[model samples]
Target: MKHYFIAHKLFLLFLAKFFLTYILLTVVYQLYLGGFQQNQIDGITQLVSQNTQQLMRVLDMDVLVLKDKGASVMVFYKQKYIARIIEGCNAISIIILFVSFIVAFSGKIKPTLLFICMGSLVIYGLNVVRIALLVVLLDAYPEQTAVWHGTIFPLFIYGVVFLLWVLWVTKILDYAKKTV
Candidate 1:
């Protein structure tokens, strides 16, 4: 057991950092969310929804993103209800997960912090675009809503995160080689 711990020390450290960061960030997010009234859309979600609408509008699609009392933000196309932009649509949780992984395999303080900020912004922008595209798709193919929303869009966002993680890890490896 001692030998195993000695050999796998780096892996163990990674696990500890990942979990601790994930939990701490999650708790902080939950607390931030808790300050809002029940069923009310948070500010982030509203911003995401608005961004999505703007993106769609830029693409020449008629769009309106609205927030009602005690309900998720609604996305409409040509005055037709197309989709809802819920808290999950904001992608803060996904950003938290991404940050945790980066921090887990952290290299230098400056680089790590910069990567976190850049990666989070990328995730946020991607999420806004994803939601915009999804709203358009939903308006076009209402029958495919389940598959598109539940599977495809998730795969797209997670796939981007996975690629970002691979990039971060490779950069860390290169940095390690230089230090050695």
Candidate 2:
């Protein structure tokens, strides 16, 4: 039993860290949502919309983002509304999950922090691009909007995160073991 506990100590620590970080971040996010004005959109959602709109502009697409009814924002392309972005679409929850996983598999303190920051920025950037491209895809294939948004795009984001995890475990964490 003693040897078993020694061997599995890191795994136990990972589980505790993951759950504590996840729970704390979730509570903070919930509190933020609760404080929003009745009909006003949350800052994160607005930021995502704004970033997506900027990306669309860079791609030379006619895109407009505007506040919709009751805490929702709508995306318009070529004068037609393409999609509505709500709180759930903001990517905060996804980021929280990503951060939790990375922290769970933490390496050295400095490297862990740096990886978390870079990984989160990558996730955020990808999420914005995902939303913009999804809007464009939906505009082009109206009949496949549900498939694209609900299935394909989600898989893309999660797939990226999974790859990141693999990279972290095999590269960053493995490197730490060699140095130690």
Candidate 3:
């Protein structure tokens, strides 16, 4: 029992450091990405609108906007979810927070009040590409639109966000530390 307690204490410390590092990374990354994403989103909106008009001449549907706020694509397609993508970045933050608290309560970390803010700019980029491809596919293969919407596009877009999260945790954040 004594040995178990000691081991748990040590493990808790490592978890704490991991969590602290994660919080710092998330905050800085969020601020950095928020601005960059806005600009990219604006550009994507323009591109999608121009292209959608040229390609899909549907009687009722229209590409009203193209922008990713955090991790969502709000496409007012004839007042429906014509084209949209939800991001997990916000959810990631919550997940991290919960993990951090769990480890902390185990007598490990002191969760930062600065708050963990997962960055989703890369996810935003993926969404732009996702929407663009969906638009193209809708035009070229109208018959297959439903399939693309339900399966292919979600996989592609969410896959990108998942990949970005993996990279951020393993690569970008690590490289950032090495450089520092």
Highest TM-score against the true fold, candidate: 1
Q: Give the top-scoring candidate (lDDT).
A: 2
**Residue ranges of candidate 3 with Cα displaced over 4 Å:** 1-119, 175-180
Candidate 2 local accuracy as lDDT?
0.90
Q: List the residue pairs that clash in candidate 3.
A: none
lDDT of 3: 0.51
* lDDT sort, best first: 2, 1, 3
Please rank every candidate by TM-score, starting with the best.
1, 2, 3
Q: Write the per-residue lDDT of candidate 2 for residues 38-156, one digit (tens) a residue.
A: 89898988999999999999999999999998789989999998889999888899889988988888878999899889988998999999999899899999999889998999999
- How many residue pairs clash in all the candidates, one count each? 0, 0, 0
How big is the positional error of residue 176 in model 2, measured in Å on the Cα after superposition?
9.2
TM-score of every candidate = 0.94, 0.91, 0.37
What are the C-alpha RMSDs, in order, of all predicted structures?
1.9, 2.2, 11.0
Q: Which candidate, 1 or 3, has the higher lDDT?
A: 1
Residue by residue across 1-180, what tens digits does model 1's lDDT show?
999999999899999999999999999999988988887888888888888888888889889988866659878888998878788789999999999999998988998999899999999999999988888788889999999999999999999999989888776435456647
Give the Cα error of residue 64 in candidate 2, in Å: 0.5
- lDDT (10s digit) by residue, model 3, range 1-180: 988878798566767766785787578647655765432533334544444443444434455554555444555544444555343322345344433543332321232222222334444444545565676576667789779988997677656555644554446445345547
Worst 10 residues of 3 by lDDT: 107-116
The lDDT for every candidate, in the order shown, is 0.89, 0.90, 0.51
